[model samples]
Each structure stands twice: as structure tokens, then as C-alpha cells.
Target chain A: SAVISQKPSRDICQRGTSLTIQCQVDSQVTMMFWYRQQPGQSLTLIATANQGSEATYESGFVIDKFPISRPNLTFSTLTVSNMSPEDSSIYLCSVAGQGVGTQYFGPGTRLLVL
Target chain B: AQRVTQPEKLLSVFKGAPVELKCNYSYSGSPELFWYVQYSRQRLQLLLRHISRESIKGFTADLNKGETSFHLKKPFAQEEDSAMYYCALRGTGGYSTLTFGKGTMLLVSP
Candidate 1:
């Protein structure tokens, strides 16, 4: 099992503003992911952040709207850009441990865009 | 495309009652299924996985490839067992991304 933490546990941002959520893992991991959970909706994968490479984003999510940066194995960041009311959701960061299928999630960042 | 479906959004059961949270998945190849739980103020944590075939915190889940389902079950539920549960699938493809189902909130009332 791995321990993960996210910064800005909860934030209220004005529309059109941007907020970057940080994810830190206690151990180095090769696979890190970003997810979004909207009100009453399932957790949706936003992107896969790999160290020193471009992130692989899922459908319906674009790089321009949610940019990701993973400078190293233990850290990654997801920036919600040009936020709107619809973008208000709980953003989660998860990391998969080596040779294991289980992924541990961070304490989600609850963003409320006003 | 891999997908997970959790039919129930909420489930309420009395303490010490049997509880089952249904989860079904759609995947072509071998699937790695997992059950994650989130307590009221805690982070989402892996409760159990089918591949491990082990029980955690008195909870267990079995993968039924024939039915394409992996449902979580617990006998004699406890009040502390109340939490938001999510069923997730890991695709075997190179990406190793996880697709999660809509979570189920289990309310074990004492």
C-alpha cells in the first residue's frame, strides 16, 4: 500500500480562475493518474501523468482545460484551467504501486467554483 | 472500452445484517477488479482485490468472469463499515488506467 496526499484540501475559486492541485506519494511510482468526481457522478479519469513525458488524457478531457505535469516519480500536479461552475468537482490523484494492480488515492481536493 | 457499473447508489442495512453491494463490469480481456472504500473523512483506500483473493476488514469480493461482475459482500455488518464504496477495473492494455463505477454509499445504522 502507498500513502498519498493532495494540497488545498478544499478551495473556492471564482469563475475563469485556475487552480493547480498537487499530489505527493511516499514512494516513487511510475503510474500516476488524475481523476474528477462530479456531483452524483462516477469517478472519471482525466489523464495519466508519467514522469518526464506528456500526459495521456482521456476522452472528453483536453490538455488545454486540464494540464498535468509530473516532473518526478513521487510528485505530480493537475491544473484546472479557466474554471467554470461545471468544473466544480472533487479532484483526486492516485498512484499505482510497483507490480501491483491496486491504486491508492489521495485525500481529494474539493473545488467549488463560484 | 472497459466500463464498470454499480447498480445501487445507496444501501441501508441494520448493524449485524448481511450486506451486498453489486458491481458489474464490461471488459473484453482479463480484468483486474478492485473494491475501494472511503470513510466519512478519510481518503479512498483499497478494500480488496479479486486477484489477491483475500478479505480486508471483514469484507470480501469475488470476481465472476462468467457474469462479468465483482460484487462486495460482508456478513454481520458493523456501524464502522458505513462508507462510500467504488468498484474499479484495470485494463490489461499498456496504459494501465483504471475505470471506476459510480460509488455506492453504504449506511449501516445501529
Candidate 2:
């Protein structure tokens, strides 16, 4: 299992502001994914970040809203742009293990837009 | 569309009681199921997977393809088992992103 560390564990941001959450894995990985978990709701996949390539965004999520960056195999970033109150949620970063669909997750960044 | 369903939002059981957290999936192709747990202050982590066919922390889940169910079960619930459990299914896309269900919060009281 990989140990992932995400920065800004919890943050309070004003509407119209943007926040970039960093995810650093202890070891190199092939794929990293970002997810959004609204309060009392299921997780929704935001995008998949692969090194040196454009991310694949899921339905309802667009790069203009959630821009992603993957500089290398062990690091990635997800920026929630022009945040709104509705953007308040827990953002998690995960990596797919080599052998299976099993994923390891970061501690998650809790964003509260006011 | 690939999706996961966790029917119970919350389940409360006494210690030593049997517990079952139901999960169901909808997918057109072969599906891979996984159970992830999040303790009070911990990251969401994989507990077990249907493909591995192994039990973790005495919790077992059987994937019934015909029923599209992969319910998590344990014979005896413990206080430490209190946590939020999420059932996830692999999407058919390359790299196989996961589609998680609304988690079930299991509160095992003594």
C-alpha cells in the first residue's frame, strides 16, 4: 500500500477564491485520481491524473472548474477554481495499485467555502 | 453506467451481534468490487476486494453477479468496527477509475 499525504488538511476559503490541494505519494505510481465527497453524500470522481498527459475528466466535472497537474509519478495537484459555497466538500486523492483496481487514498482535504 | 449502491446510511448493532452492510452494483461488463473503510480520523482505505477472495478484519463479502450484490458481512460486530464503509465498483474505462456508493456508517455499541 502507498502512503499518500495531502496538504491543507482543512481550509476555509471565501467564495471566488481558488485552492490547490497537493498529494504526494511515498512511492512512484502510474495513476492518480481525484474525488469529491459532498457532505453526507457519496464520492464523485473528478478526474484521473496521469504523468505527462492530460487528465480524463468525468461527467459533470470539467477541467475549467477542477484543474489538475501531475508533474511526476509521485506527485499531483488538484485546484478547485473559483470556488463557491456549493464547492464545500472533502477532496481526496487516490492511486490505483499496480496489480488490481484497489486504491489507496490520502487523508483528504476538507474545504469549506463561505 | 457503472455505479455502486450502499442501501443503509447507518447501522447500529451491539457488540457480538452479527452485522451485514448491503452493497449492490450496476455495470454492463465484468465488475470488480471493493470495500473501503474510513475510521474517525483516518484516510479511506481498502478493506477487501471481491477479486482477492480474502477476508480482512473478519469481514467477508461475496459478489453475486446474478443479483449484482456484494454485501459485507461479519459474524460478530465489535466497537472497533465502528466506521464508515464505502462500496466501490470499477468503471470500464482504461485505468479503471472507481465509482463509490454513499457510505454506510456502522456504529457498533457495547
* lDDT of prediction 2: 0.94
DockQ of predicted candidate 2: 0.87
Instruction: Give candidate 1's root-mean-square deviation (CA, Å).
Output: 1.3
lDDT of 1 by residue, B1-110 (tens): 98999999999999999999999999988889988899999988878889889989899899998999999999989999999999999876587678889999999999
DockQ scores of all models, one per candidate:
0.76, 0.87
Candidate 2 docking category? high
TM-score of 1: 0.95
What's the distance in Å from true for residue A25, model 2? Answer: 0.9
Best by DockQ: 2
lDDT measured at residue B73 in model 2 versus the true structure, 0 to 100: 98
- Which lDDT tens digits does candidate 1 get at residues A60-90? 9999999999999999999999999999999
